[model samples]
Target: MRIAVFIKKTTFHKGYGGIETQNKSLCEGLTKRGHEVFVFSPKLELDRNSIVENGVRYIFVSCAFKMDGFFGERNKDNWFTRSAQRFEEEHAKQPFDVVIGQSSAAVGVIKRKWELNIKVVSVAHGTIISEYKTFLNNMVGLREWIKIVSNTGYVLKSFFSRQREYVHGSEKVVAVSNFVKSALVDETFVDAQKVEVIHNGVDGGARPIQAHPNNQPLKLVYIGRLERSKGLQNLLKAISRLNNVTLSVIGDGPYLPQLARLVKSLHLSERLIFVGRVAPEKIPEILSQANVFVYPSLRYEGFPMAVVEAMFCGLPVIASNIGGISDALENGTTGYLVKSGIIADLRDTIREFVNKPDLIRKMGDAAYAKAQREFNLDTMLSKYEKILEDVVK
Candidate 1:
């Protein structure tokens, strides 16, 4: 099958995000299965217009405006839509069996469905409405507040207009989690029948279980963008209350300075270590060195890839009990889930693991087992393949 994947930007162009990771994973997976997968993205510093890597082909489209920034909101000239049209025209001889569009890319694909003459599947990672609300609630200052307020209009317009077309306009909709599926159907009025829940998967079976010595300090790791909604501040607050535990933050974002200030004010400079933006390949090694994985996100997540990656690396997770996180972890089995924003509860959960260090190894074993059984990469790829094939038929 010839598949065209439309994403605003990808890891190919130094775009780092869960959506980009998923897009790359899906494309590579399909390519491995002997399907010809073509990924379309805005032009970047590529050596050529197109490049084939890991059995998949990447096509870079040159547009008048660069659709950079989060959610590609900086694209005031509809660069993605224009790029899609150009891709269609350039590849006019070869028709795609199906076009898989991720989030914002879906809007452009839906707009050109008639011209492309292909089945379109819009993959919804999360809802814009929920994200807008999260940003509004987490606004730090007047600048952030004004920015969110301005973007709120676009989000509202997308929710009422483009979002509906993106959801209803596609042949089928792929929701990364049950939480995402519910949000699409309940919030956007997308047909529940058209929405399919497919949890994101990760490559497993790499590292063997490493022992966490009882005499050593409790090693806690949080791997994600250091944003306000990620609850890193809440994690810092909870950790400050604890005694012997140490946290290794393995990502970078705008909120790093604020978090650093909070650490200083709380006098937790010694307990916290920020290893900003480690390469993806080095994550397992980093996770192997830790005993517990903490993801204290306050917002609704569409199946956090970091949590699953941690689970795959044989570390038990202590994440907030919200969104798709609940689906990823079975409380008391794989790991514990604390109530969002409840500092006492989070602190207590950390203490539970700290006091009973043996439970950490036990939960880590269970987490690895769960990750192998449920979140295997091949399983996710096969499901996606079937969906794409079925959609086209």
Candidate 2:
């Protein structure tokens, strides 16, 4: 089968984010399995608007309209109309059997569907529904916020309207998790039959690391952007309450300095180490080196790829019990789930894990087993393949 995979950005093994990394894996996996794959992403990293990676061709296109209105943050316009035109020019050479758009690339995908007559499958990262109602509340009662706030509403409205159109225009809509499915169905009013849940897969495998082997400090790792919504402050507060647990934070974002100051103010400078950003390929090694992985995000995340990567590395995970995390971690069995934003509960969970070191082994083993059985990369790619096959047939 020939498939056209669409995402907003693409990077090599090093600079890519979760979605990009997953798209890369899916593209590579699909190609290796005898299917032809083409990746359509922004040409931000490319000099010639295209590059071929691992036998699959990547077509980068610019967006005409500024996505700031679409995504609620101002970003450089990507000549999307030009990109769609380029795609049309290329489609004449070789047509794709199916088109798969990840996240909110519905507009571009819809345009592609009109040109190609191929089935379009939208993989929603998370729809703006009841869970995002909080954002709406934040936008109200502010002057000059009218434009951006209106745009935010416009974006959500467009999301629902386009999603409905895409659902009717294409073959299927894949929600990243059941939590996302609920958001689409109840919050967005998407037909349940049109949506399917396909959890993101972890890339590499993780093995249990032996702690206390040579008197090394217990290493705890948190990977991903250092945003307030991700609960880094809560982790710092919880770490200040605990003893002997050293935290190593990988990744950087707007809130890095703020998080650093919080650690200092809490006198946790010695316990918390912020490593800033690192390469994606190095993440597994970092995970293997750590004793536990903490993801205390307070936001309604779709599903964190970091938590799954930690599980694959066999690190005992402690995370917020929100969205699909409960489905991912299997709380008390695979990993510990603390109440969202509860610093005390986070501290208590850390203390429990520290005191009962044996629980780490049990949960780590469970996590590894779960990763091996349920979240294998090949299995995820295959599931996608089956769906595309059905859609095309």
Candidate 3:
């Protein structure tokens, strides 16, 4: 079947975060299954606007922030009106069998379905509505207050409009987890039957390397965007409480500078290595070197891709017991899940792991087994293809 998958931006390993990685994986996975896949993303770089890889084709539409401008203020240009015009003009020569839009707010599929009379599917990655509300609620100060007042209605309207589209536009909503689907159903008032929970898969092609946690140096790794919601600060504080455990912070975001300052203030410069923005391809190697994989995300996450990757690499995950995280990792079985946002809980969890170093390998092996059983890329890809077929029929 011919499929048109829409995402906000397209990037390779070195480019950006989870959304891009997942889109790329899905495109490749679909192509591997002998399906004609076309990726529609905004052209971030000035160089090549279009590229075809393997059996998958990519068309990059012009947007404000290039690739990095996903949530930037300049994303208004990629709306349903503009994207629909571009998509129609580009595909006028050829049509697609199905249309799937990632990042549910990319309402271009809403226009695409209406114009082309095709099945459009919108995949909700996280609690976008709640996140927007949190963003609005966090706005403070005098001049900033003015900006919030002027644009508050617009954000609120856009949030509600996207919720409506996700509910009505697509054949059904593709949620990364039951947690995300529940959030959408409860918050957006979408019918529960209209949403399907498909967990994110890990690219297990990377060979797993064994690195025993020797008494020399215990390594802790966090691989994802270093945002405030990711609870990096809490991880840093926990690190400060412990001794001889060096943390290699992977990935980068707006919270880096503040986090760096915090690290300096806490005198954890030697203990913490902030290796900003490592590629997802190189993550398994990094995970192999570490004794523990820590993802202390405090916010409402859909399902963390990096954590699954870590588990696939046979690293015991130390993550917050929130959202779909608990669903993924069995508490005290595969990995330890601490209470979200509690410094004491995280600190204690870290200490527990530190005291019982041998338990790391046992939990890591269990996590690896779980990954092979449930979180393998092939299994996830098959499930997604079946869902698409079900939706299209």
Highest lDDT against the true fold, candidate: 1
lDDT of 3: 0.77
Count of backbone clashes, every candidate in sequence: 0, 10, 1
Residue 84 alpha-carbon offset, candidate 3, angstroms: 1.2
TM-score per candidate: 0.93, 0.89, 0.89
Candidate 1 lDDT score relative to the true structure: 0.84
Q: Each candidate's root-mean-square deviation in Å?
A: 2.7, 3.5, 3.5
Model 3 lDDT at residue 124: 83
lDDT, candidate 2, 223-276, per-residue tens: 988777788888888888777789999998877888888877999887777887
Tens-digit lDDT string for candidate 3 (126-175): 76565665455444468657776546655565566655765677887888
User: Which of the two candidates, 2 or 3, achieves a greater lDDT against the reference?
Assistant: 3
Mark the 10 consecutive residues where model 1 has the least summed lDDT: 65-74
TM-score of 2: 0.89
Residue pairs in collision within model 1:
none
- How much is 245 displaced in model 2, in angstroms? 1.0
The runs of at least 3 residues in candidate 1 whose Cα sits more than 4 Å from the true structure, single-residue gaps closed, are 44-48, 64-77, 205-211
